[model samples]
Target: MSEATPPADAGNTVSVAVSALDLGALLCSRVCHDVISPVGAIVNGIEVLEDEGAADMREVALDLIAKSARQASARLQFTRLAFGAAGSAGARLDLGDAEQVVRQVLEDDRTKIEWSLPRELLPKNRVKLLLNLVLLAGTTIPRGGVIRVAGVGEGDGMGFVLTSTGTNARIPAGIEALAGGAVPQGGLDAHSVQPFYAGMLARDCGLPLRFALDGDTATLTAA
Candidate 1:
C-alpha cells in the first residue's frame, strides 16, 4: 500500500467516481460476505438439530447455533452503524455505543481492540467513519494482533488514529488509493468498496485520511 495525502482543502468533498447504485450494491455484497459464514453455520446447526439421527450431537449443534447467532448479530449491528443509515439525517451518535458495537464485531481470539476515545456524542457520520476505520485497520493484521485507537481531538475538530500491530502486519494492497478516493486498477468491488467508503466518509466529515506502515505496525490517521 502507498501513502495517502490529505486533501488540500479538507472541506472539499473527495470525488468518488462510482454510481450510487453500484456503490450500494457493492456495500451490500460486502456485508453479505461478512455475515454469510456464520449464517450458513446457523442453518447447518438447525438442520442438525432437526435430524433425529443426530440426537447424539445435540450439545454440539446447540453450541454451534448459539455461537453463530452471536456472530451474525454482532456483524449486523456493526454494519448497521458503519455502513447503514444508522439514524435520521443530522443525527448524533455516542462514541460509547460505537465502541460497544466495534468491540462486539471484532470479538475473536485472534484480534484485540484498545479503544481510548471518550464517551462523547458526535455526528452520526463521524462515528461511522471511526468504525469503518477500525474495520479497515483490522484487516492489516490478518495473522492476529492488536488495534489501538485514540482520539485526536474533540467535537467538530475530532479525528482518529488506529494502529494495528502484529507479526507481518501489512497494509492491504490498493487500500491507500481506495481510501484516498481513487478507483483502484481492479475497479470497485465488494472487497475494495470499504476503503473507498471510508474515504468518502472522511471527506464528508472534513477530515483528511492518511495511512502509514512501519515495521509490523500499520497506522491509519484521519484528521
Candidate 2:
C-alpha cells in the first residue's frame, strides 16, 4: 500500500488545538501544585512526631501540622469553588463566602486582602471568575503585598476591580495573551492554564476583563 501525503496545515492546526482532556489535566496539575507543599509539610510533621528522639521538637511539630492542615484545607476550599463545578447549574453564590475563602488562601504575614464586596449573591461562575482573578492578583506580587477587591453594580450588571500593590509589583508574564485565548509559545501547561481559564469564565459571564500595570501596582478589572 502507498502512504498518503499529510496536509501542509496539519502541524499548525494541531499546535493550537488544546483538547478538553489536556485542559482538564493542566488544571488538575495546577491545583495539585498549589496544595502539595502544605500537604508535604503535614507529612513531615507526622514523621517528626514518629521519631522518638525528636520529642524535644514535639511542640514545633504540632504547630507545623496545625498550620499545614489549615493551609491545605484553605487551598482545597478555594480550588473547589474557583476551579471545580461548584453548586448546581445557574445557581447563585454569596460574595460573603467568596471573601472568606479568598481571605483564607491569600492572606498571610506578607500578603493581605482588602475585600470591599457587598454581601450579595452573584452567579456561581461570576463568583468563580472573581476568585480566579483574586488568585492572579495575589501572584503579581510574589514578594508579598496587598490585594484590594471591590465590586460594582448589581445583578447582571455586576463587575469587579482588584489591585495588587507592593514593591516590585508588575503584571504577570504571558497573562495578557493567555487571557485573550492565545496558547502560549511554550505550550499550555499548569502555569498558563489559569489565565486562559479566567478569560473563558469572563466570556461566559459576559464581562470584559482587563489587566493594567501602573508603577508598582497591578490591577485586574472585569466590567
Candidate 3:
C-alpha cells in the first residue's frame, strides 16, 4: 500500500467556525424569542374568534388579530438587524439602523437611556459589533438606568464608547471578562453569551477594545 498525506487546509481546524455557527444558533434563538409572543397571541385570538362566531365581540377579536400582525411585523424589522446575514464584506450600517438595533433590544419599559453618540458615523460591521455589546449591557440592568453613548470623531475612524449605570444592576460576570478580552475559554458560549462580536469587530477594523470596569461602572471603548 502507498502512503497518503493529509490535505493542506486540513490543518485549518474549526474553532472559530464552530463558534460562528453557535453564534448563529444563538441569534436564531433570539429571533424566536422576539417572535413567539406575538405569534402565540395571534393563535389565541383566532381561537377566540372561532368561539365568538360572529357576535359583537368579533370586533374585539379582529383588533387583537391586527395587533398580533403588527407585532409580527415589528419583530421582522427587528430581526433583519439582530440576525441579518450580512457579515463584513464592506457592508456599512448608518446610525439609523444602529439606533434601531440597540433601541429594539432596550425598548422594553425596564430601562431608559441618556445617549450621546454620533447619529450617523458607523459602518455596518461596526454597528453589528456595537449592537452585540449594547445588548450585553442592556442585559445587565433589569431595573434600568442611564446609558451614555459618547464618541470621538477621528479623521478616518471614529472611536465610540458605551457606559451604563443603574441602581440595581450587577453587570454579569460573563460580560465583565469578555469586555476585558479575558472571556471564558469556551467558544460561542463565551462570544455569544458575552460581546465577542465587538472584540472581533475591533480586530477586523484594526482597532483595539479598551475596557474599564469598577463597582458600578462599565465602559467599552472602540478605537
lDDT of 2 by residue, 151-200 (tens): 86877569999989998887665676677677755688888799889988
Please give the range of 10 consecutive residues that has the lowest summed lDDT in model 3.
Answer: 1-10
Q: Residues 1-223, candidate 1: write the lDDT tens digits.
A: 4553443433333345798999999999999998999999999999999999999999999999999999999999999999999889999999999999998988579999898999989999999999999989988898989999999988867999999999998777667767878875456878879989999999999999888888888899999
How far out, in Å, is residue 179 in model 2?
Answer: 0.8
Better of 1 and 3 by lDDT: 1
lDDT of 2: 0.85
Q: List candidate 1 segments past 4 Å from native.
A: 1-16
**lDDT: which candidate is best?**
1
What TM-score would every model get versus the actual structure?
Answer: 0.91, 0.89, 0.70
**Using lDDT as the measure, what is the rank order of every candidate, best first?**
1, 2, 3
Q: Estimate the overall C-alpha local distance difference test score of candidate 1.
A: 0.87
For residues 1-223, could you state the per-residue lDDT of candidate 3 as single tens digits? 1211222333322333335667677767666777888888888778878884667777787898898887787767656654575556666666666676566456656666656665674666666666665766676566687677766564337767777677655545444334434434444452344365556666776667755555466566676
Q: Which ten residues in a row have the lowest lDDT in candidate 2?
A: 1-10
User: In model 2, what lDDT does residue 38 have?
Assistant: 99
Best by TM-score: 1
